[model samples]
Target: MTQDLYRLIYLSRNTIPGSNENIHQEIEQILAVSRQRNAASQITGALMFNRECFAQVLEGAHDDIQATFERIQCDPRHADVVVLDFKPVEARRFSHWSMGYIGYDTLASKEFTQIQQATGFDAKQFSGERIYDLLHAHLYAAEKAGSGLGKIA
Candidate 1:
C-alpha cells in the first residue's frame, strides 16, 4: 500500500534579532539545513519569511510531518509557533522542492506591501489555506517567469 501523505501548515513570529545581512545569512543557514533534512526524510515544502514572521507548508508522511513540526516548535528562532492546518493530502503541492524559500526580495514591493498591510505580520490574521495559496502562487509565478528567486531545489 502507498504510504499516507499529509500536509502541515504553520505560522511563527521570527525571533532572530540582527541586522538585515545577519538575518539573511541566518535564513540561508536555515534553508540549507532544512533542505538537507527534508530531502532525506522525503519531505516537500515551501517557506516564506518577511523578517517579522514565517509561514510554511510541509508535506510528507504523518509521522515525518509531526516530527518536523515538533522540531520547529522547539526552535529558538521561532516564537509563538502555531499550526494552522494538519491533515491528509492527496498529493504534494511542492514536490520539486525539499524546502523552497521565499524571502522578502522574492516578491515585488507593491505585493509585499499589500500583504504586510493586510496581515501586519500577524499569524492570527491568516489561515493555513491562505498561506498555502500565497506561497503556491508566488512559487508558480517565479517559476514561470524564470526568476529563480526562491527555487532552492
Candidate 2:
C-alpha cells in the first residue's frame, strides 16, 4: 500500500522568555533535534524564523506529522501555536530536506523581497498558503544548490 501523506503548517510567536542569546541557542538546539527526528521519521519540511515568530511546514505520514506537531505544541519556547493549514497531499514539497531552515539574515535579499511581497513581510499578515509558497522557494533553492536550508540569500 502507498503510504499516506499529510501536510501541516503553523505559526507561533517566539515566547522564549529570556535573553536573546538564550533564545538563539534554544532555536539552534530545536533545529538540531528536529533534523534528526524528522529524518528518522521520513518527514520533510521547512522552518522559518523571522526574529519574532516562526512559520513551519511539516509533511509526512499522518501519524508522524500529527505527533510532531503535538510535540511542538508542548514546547515552552514558543506560544500561541496556530495551525494555518493541515491536509492530505499528493507529494512532499520538501522531499530533499528533513527540516530545512531560514532565518532573519535573508530579510534583505531581493528574492526574499519578492516572497515578502507575495506572502506579506510580516509573519502575522501571511496566509497559510503564502507561507507554504515562501518555504517551498527556499527548499527548492537549497536543493538545487546542493546545500542545506538556512543558506538562502
Candidate 3:
C-alpha cells in the first residue's frame, strides 16, 4: 500500500448497558468535529456492531485515526476494544464515507431476541455481518447509526 493509503481497523464494544441512545449523542459530536476539519481530508470508515461486539475500518492520516480511536475507547459509553487489524490498505473497502457506521445498541431489540430464540447462540461468539443484520431488522436507519462509525471503524 502507498504511504498515503493507510487504514485503521478496530472494534468498539459498549461499556454502558441500556446506553444505546447516549452513544448517538457522542457520535454527533464526533461528526461535527470531523466535518469541521474537512470530511475529505480526515476520513474515518465503517462499523458493524454485533449486540456484543463492534468492528471497524478507519482510513486517513495514521496518527489521526489512532488518536481518534483512543478517544472513543476512553469514552465511557464503550469498552473492550480489540483492534483486530491495522496497517496499510491495498485499496479502500469502505472508502466512501467521512465516518459511516452503526452502534451496537442497534441490536437491543426484536432481532437480537429472535437470534437468541433461534440459535440459542450466545452473542459473545457471533461475528461478521451477522450482528449488523440483526440490528438492521430491529432498528430504524436513523436509530441504527449515521456517521460516527460508532468507534468500530
Candidate 4:
C-alpha cells in the first residue's frame, strides 16, 4: 500500500545571533544538514529565510513530518515556533527539492517586497498556505527563467 502524503507549514523567529556572514554560514549549514536528513526521510520542502524570520513548508509522510517538526521546535536556532498549517495533501508541491532555500536578498527583490509590505516578515502574521504559495511561486519563476535560485541538489 502507498503511504499518504502530508504537508506542514511553519514560521519561526531567527534566533541565530551573529553578523550577516556568520548568519549566512549558519543557514548554509542548516540547508546542508536538512537536505541530507530530508532526503533520507523521503521529505521534500522549501525554506525561506530573512534575517529576522524563517518560513518553511515540509511535505512527506505524516510521521516523518511530525518527527521533523518536533526536532525543529526544540532547536536553539529557532524561537517562537508556530505551525501555520498541517494536513493531508493530495500531492507534493516540492517534489523535486529535498530542501530548497530562499535567502534574504531574493526576498528583498521588488516582486517579493510587495509581499513583505503586505504580510510583513513576522512569523506570527503568516498563514501556512501563504508561505507555501510564496515559496512555490519563487520556485516556479526560477524554473521558468532557467535560474538556479534555490536549488541545492
Candidate 5:
C-alpha cells in the first residue's frame, strides 16, 4: 500500500525431478510476464539454482513485488516456498535494472560445477548455500562489469 521499497524473496526446492523438458519453457513465460510487471513497478532480481533448489532476490515496490511472488508461489516448477528473507530496503542494490534475466545459458549453467570445484562443495551441499553465495557474487559481478563503470567508479 505504501510506496516504500521492498525485496520479495523466497527459497524453494525443486519439484519436477530433474526434467528440463518444461523448466526452460516455464522460465521463458515468467520472463515474458516479468517485462510487463517491470513496466508497472520497479523490479530487479536474480534466480539461482543448484541441482535441486532455487533462491532468489527481488527488489521493487511492495505491491508489484508481492504480486510477482504470488505468481511464483503457484508456479508448478518449484514447491515448498519458504520466505528465507524479506524486508524493506532503503537503497536497492539493483536500482539500475528493471527486470534482469538469468537462465540456463552455457555460461550461467556452468556456474554449478565451477562453484563446486572452486568452493569445494558438492552439488547438493549446504542446502544450496554455495549456489546462493556465488549467485550474489557473480550476478552482481556481471552486472557491475556490464554496467560499463570499468577502471574508474
Candidate 6:
C-alpha cells in the first residue's frame, strides 16, 4: 500500500532574545538537532533564514509532518508562525536532504538574482506553488555552483 505524503511550509519571525551572535548560534544548534531527528523520521525539507525571519518546508508522512509542525509552533525561537501551505504531495521536493538550509546573505549571489528580482526575495511573500518553484530553482542553482546551499544527506 502507498503511504500518504504531506508537505508543510511555514514562515515565522525569529524571536530569540539575544545578541546577533547568540541568535546565529541558536539557529545552528536547531539545525543540527533537526537534521538528526528529521532523518530518523524520514522527513525531508529546507530551511531559509535571514536573521530577522525564517521559512521552512517539511515533507514526509502526514502524521510525521503534523507532529513535527506542532512542536515547531511551540518552540520559543519562532514567533508569528504562519503556515503558508500544507497538503499531500506526490513526491518529496528536497528528497536528498533531511534539512537543507540557506541564509539571506545569498540574496546578493548571482544565482539568486532571478528570485530576488521577481519577489524582492521576501520570505513572507513566499507561499504555495511559488515556494516550491523558488526552492527547486534555488537548490538547482546551489547544487550546480557547488556553494551557497546543499543537502544534509
Number of colliding residue pairs in model 1: 0
lDDT of each: 0.81, 0.78, 0.54, 0.81, 0.61, 0.76
Candidate 6 stretches with Cα past 4 Å from truth are 108-126, 147-152
TM-score of each: 0.87, 0.81, 0.55, 0.86, 0.64, 0.82
lDDT comparison, 1 vs 2, better candidate: 1
What is candidate 3's lDDT per residue for 65-96, written digit by digit as tens? 76677776787756766664567666654444
lDDT of 3 at 75: 70
| Model 2 lDDT tens row, 19-123 | 878877888899889988898888888888766778889999999999999999999888888888999988887887788887766642344445546766455
Q: List the residue pairs that clash in candidate 4.
A: none
lDDT of 5 at 60: 78
lDDT-superior candidate, 1 or 5 = 1
Error of 3 at 140 (Å): 18
What are the per-model numbers of colliding residue pairs?
Answer: 0, 0, 3, 0, 0, 0
Off by over 4 Å in 1: 108-122, 147-153
- Candidate 5 local lDDT, 54-89, one digit each (tens): 667777778878887888899887887777556787
How does residue 82 of candidate 4 score in lDDT? 82
Residue 38's lDDT within candidate 4 is: 92
Question: Model 2: C-alpha RMSD to truth?
Answer: 4.2
Rate residue 105 of model 2 by lDDT.
66
What TM-score does structure 6 among the candidates reach? 0.82
lDDT of 2: 0.78
User: Which lDDT tens digits does candidate 6 get at residues 56-150?
Assistant: 88999999999889989999998888888998888887987788777666752233344434768565565556656666677667878885343
